[model samples]
Target: MRSFLLLSGLFCSLLSFAQTDTLPVFPETPPLLEDVLQDAEEEVDFDFDTYYEPLEALREHPLDLNRADREQLQEIRLLNDLQIEAFLEYRATAGPLLALYELQVIPGFDLPTIRRLLPYVSLRSSLDDFHVPLPRMLSAGKNELYLRWSRTLESSRGFLLAGDTSVSGRFLGDPNKWYTRFKHSYENRLSYGFTAEKDAGEEFFRGSNPQGFDFYSAHLFARNLSRTVKAVALGDFTASFGQGLILYSGFGYGKSAATMEVKRSGRVLRPFTSVNEASFYRGAAATLAFGPLEATVLGSYRRRDGNVVVSTDTTETQDLPAITLSSILNSGLHRTPAEIADEGAFHQLTFGGCLRYSSDRFAFGLNGVLDRLDQPISRTPQPYNRFYFNGNQLWNGSLDYTYRLKNLLFFGETAVDPNGRLATLNGLLAGLDRKVDVSLLQRWYSHEFQSLNGFPFAETNGVNNEAGVYLGAEIRPASRWRLNAYYDLYRHPWLRFRTDAPSRGRDWLVRLTYYQKRKLEVYLQVRRESKEQNATDYFGPLDRLVAHQTLQARL
Candidate 1:
């Protein structure tokens, strides 16, 4: 990881010193982004591009604070609802902002928050939403192209025998990994881009991949094109509705050191520009606004890679055997013959819509989504997998609400599967003082509930068979010092993989940070987690669950 960071730093230095004036100069990567990447280093399928591309786009076309609406502000993801409400109220009473430093007067917008927003916002008011000519919108946009490649310097055994077809476990292609991206953006209104990638050991421009790259994604997104149409997306995209129970794709926020920023907030529709192959829809989606009410509808059809199981009957006379999917794979890798065999094993069709009404003090949303597959999915049955969804079709509907009363903001979502099982999440954010803010969240998801694309804040990877309460607080004790902490207590009501019975857990985290004027910054974080898992030393046929604890601290 250190070497990788050094290489990235060197590359950025070269770009920064280049003679080309057209190249955009990006600000330093935010600490929040670095923390997210470091936390997920253990995840084999994690892609850094999924999170970096949006910030890059924001730098290229910074948001106009005077003209950006509530939805656009929320997409920034740096401000909480309380802060947003405060900013909007301030703007309503004070007129358009004359200077960026005026944010210091807002109740919840502290110096730290203002500093974070400096890179992504501008005080100048841009063009009106209406009467924008198409030719100018296209010709005035910024165009960018990026190409990157990486390969291991050491000679591994597999790469040494690259062309040995008779040898087992030999690499089918070279060790080079390649990536390319091209984008055009017209300020904050329009964006279009395409991303292509080829993983190491994957054939390029030959054999399995004659198309040059293993994966390709492209999208065209426009915002505020008309009074009725707030946003529209064509090609690849992602959708997120209230609390992410019905539909959520792309990057997500979860439990982290930034305790107060836990809520899921973003635009209802966003263009897909990441290299992640399976997490986005590949069709079209649109959002329409009328007064205070808004409507969003989307439809998508795409191929999915899955582990296919063929019928074992030998007496069948047919040339091809009946096949069923055992599981879906999201690694987006096709380096080996076995991995290649699972490519595009099935096709999926998805359609969904959301209806929302928003005002100064209240908001409500109704979301519905349905997914259908060309082939049936039947996982190998196990005690832990009994409640998993299996079939050709699945549907879910949810209702989410948010209300603001003075200094407190309340939000929650309730969803139901076709079987009538329920999943719910609710939370509250309160500003007790100018320098103190706190948050509370609770969730209950039945074991029978299932979601394919939903990503929520929880201890477990999936949002089922769990109930928990989380309490978080942030405080500025002094001029340059801040304190953050959170505690979560959760329980799984049903059997999980490797566990024979119900289990419970608790997590605690505390972080202290100090920031000095433009010269020095430091932070210390300590975290402890205790959970139940099967005992490793048990000699009995059926292992017993035992408590396990782990502690970590970093500075």
Candidate 2:
């Protein structure tokens, strides 16, 4: 944890850079985004670049509300489905909005929600120029460049031992961290950029990284190319579909104060500008539209870091000793010989496609994906890992749907692995009245079910071996005060890492927020969670499971 905090401090230089235009380069993050970032920073698996791109882009080119669609509005990350639906319904009946304040009349658009939405949205005439020539678009596009450098004020243990060649675990590079990026983009139509980074104790222009930075990523994305072609991407990018059961890449929200915002929504293909190496794909993808039907296809091939184990025993199927992998490394740190050896040690190939049909009230889709690895994965046998994935090849297929009727909305996804294992998630959102809204979701995953790239709403970390139900509500008692609350109950039928036996858990949260628009904003939040875990006082041969509870309050 100390090392992670140091790395975050290293990024302080990143915020010191100045943009050419000097137009509020990066505004203060909204409350919702701020909360998500705080949670992501605590877990080192996420790349900060993923969150920065969208915010920067929106600041540079605000969305035109009159022309924005459902998906575009959701991209702001500040509005929930209930609000979006209400806004769309209001727009359909009231016609193109003439002013930003017109939103006050829309259902679910309270003062706080409006304040959060103000910066990223604008009221533009629908009759604005619909088409522009390629040359003009290229000449008018925006360009940005950023460079940052940082180093510790004093030498740490890693630096003291770096020069000792006899020490195998010593750092291999200097103590500085460097980052640089260049981006060019036009409105939302086209974007191309490249980012390079070198972490502390990593090689730079020598040793293992003779070419320069230890990691480099580039991408080219274009949308609304033609009437038939919706979007295209080359180089690096991410894909998210349905409710994120089978395939979802990039950052996603789990449990938050906005309880009804559990469903995942976004464009299928988005450009990858983050430094996180493991959560992106390098290749090409395209989305085509035909009337009410749309199709997306993609292919990716990349080398990944992994812990490789070479066996001494010979196998009957081959002349050489068998080679297997114990785990895939995602930290993106290579400061020692052991860490460097694990870098790009294995190859992965992924191919997938999705087909969807949509209307104003409902939508349906089918998704399929295949992943193959050059080396097989073999985990050390353990009672808890009996259901973990092994071998080299995997494939999954799923069906997802969404239907909106009056004030009620329904969404779900059901997926299956090659072995017939099942995983499913379903949810409902209802605007009970002008002052209240409620949500309910239920999920079930077989013990053998596994999703290597899925990040869905669940009690556990991943989307497997869990069954739970969630109920949440949001109430606007008055113009300046609002309340939010939720309760969740879950159980694990199989043994967990710390708990030696089947366990169950329950969690609940309540938050009250006060809003005065631009004047003042404050909130009080309380949460308590209880779950079964091994007891520390037990002296029996077998560990005893006991209920443990945690309580927290924040303002």
Candidate 3:
């Protein structure tokens, strides 16, 4: 009996090893005999109902139509690539879809496909409300069309005319200035639109010079990919390079110096003549990102021709190229507030530069600029002198620090320009003509900031010695409000011409703002300045006050 039992055990062991190697392995031991038998029975009971249950659940909980992409839409098994493309193109041209039957109009979409997709599409306005529903008047695939028209009326005081007329005029505001725009988008990814404006005002008048349609901007663009890359073009657009040292092009509208005047004894006294010039720069810019590194490059050319002085034509043409590179770290030697408490810190270091070459067919100059920003210090400096001197003769550097104190943000920067002497030399050179000798007319022509002739009445060259510290804070008391305050202490040793006098000055600015939904914002600011003068033979005080209010709205 014992021999027979041993032989039987050996046979069973061989059978178990064979089963383990040949079949899928579960745990160390197989399920109980009863459970295994029951599982087998369940597999035999499988039918179409079991498969359709999950499919029905997924269809009832389909993805949001507003944000769904082609892949997600295809997962429903009712749409294909061609159908998706047609739908996207149609929606882009027609606007938001309002009915799912509209999909039948798209190529490749048929009755069977629409019936299969009916349970998974919705026409709700809110993305969160998107859910399976029966067909209704408003369906997900039907496009909606909307049209809008607007007009603006603005009056200007103290407006300056480009002719021989004096700096005084009050004319009727532009009455027929109208704006029209058309936009159509589907799934928020595919979109296209066009906008145009027309104005009938005195400026557009021919013989009598009535402002009518002085300027207009029109553009048409479509977004190919919304998440990663986007493309845009404008007939007349504006952009800046680096810090505006190399390139800055756009339409600028502000108080023109010629139009701005001071009221003395009820008489308007103009400080400086003003010129209004408007033009457009056509260009392209893009940003690329890979892991912790990012790069941005842009290039553009602009042509501006307008009135500078009465009767004298001024035109300038310029080309600019700019690039920037940055590296980010999440831990180790460089750390930021985001990584400080989690055994590491996130930091970023960036280096960027731009160059601009300007020419007017007769004169040309090349301007180059460089900037560097490392952890704890973000430096930004423009090499204006390099462009004027035609070499790398000027350098500016800065060190900045940012520290997070619980819920507070504290930051400061210390900047220095070692090549200030070169700037001073340039100012002196500008005061002299090509003959290298100072001209009497040039003396008076030199402004207060650029004069270096060592005028006996004032120390005109002293502004070259400039060094200062800026300390400010951003305080948030409410979710929609903020306060900013800053103090500046600047010392100019060159401003001190006589002994036993203070040469330092102090200035401060405080601003308060209220923001709501990033759409509406208002701010109030105040500034005060005090300085002593020894070169001008005047020492006590000079102060100025300015205040203004502005408003903006977008739909």
Q: What TM-score do all the candidates reach, one by one?
A: 0.92, 0.92, 0.31
lDDT tens digits, residue span 1-555, model 1 = 211221231112122211233544555556655555555526444555445545566775678888877877877667877788778878988899998889889887767778888888888666675688766665566666767777766757877776777766666777887887777767667878798989888899998899899999999988888899889999999999789877888777677777777778878898888878788998999999999999999999999999999986555476576789999898888877777889999999999999999998899999999999999999999998899989999999999999988788899999999999999999999989878889999999999898877788778877699999999998888878888899999999999998889999999889999998677789999988899999989989887999899888989
User: Comparing candidate 2 with candidate 3, which one achieves the higher TM-score?
Assistant: 2
Q: What's the count of clashing pairs in each model shown?
A: 0, 0, 23
Clashes of 1: 0
Off by over 4 Å in 1: 2-21, 41-62, 154-170, 314-320
Instruction: For residues 1-555, write the lDDT of model 2, one tens digit per residue.
Output: 333333332222222223345432455666665655443425553444556556666765678888888988887778889999999888888999999999998888888788777877887555443366656555566776666677776777878999799988899999888887777777678778898999889999999999999999999998887778888999999998788888998777776777777888888999988888788888999999999999999999998999999988875777798889988888889999899999998999999899999998999899999999999989888898899889999898899999998789999999999889999999999999989999999999888987777778887777788899999999999999989889999999998888899999999889999978678879898888899999999999999999999887889
Judged by lDDT against the true structure, how good is candidate 1?
0.82
lDDT of 1 at 441: 97
Candidate ranking (lDDT, best to worst): 2, 1, 3
lDDT-best of 2 and 3: 2
* Candidate 3 local lDDT, residue 436: 16
Question: Cα lDDT for residue 473, model 3?
Answer: 41
- Higher-lDDT candidate of 1 and 2: 2
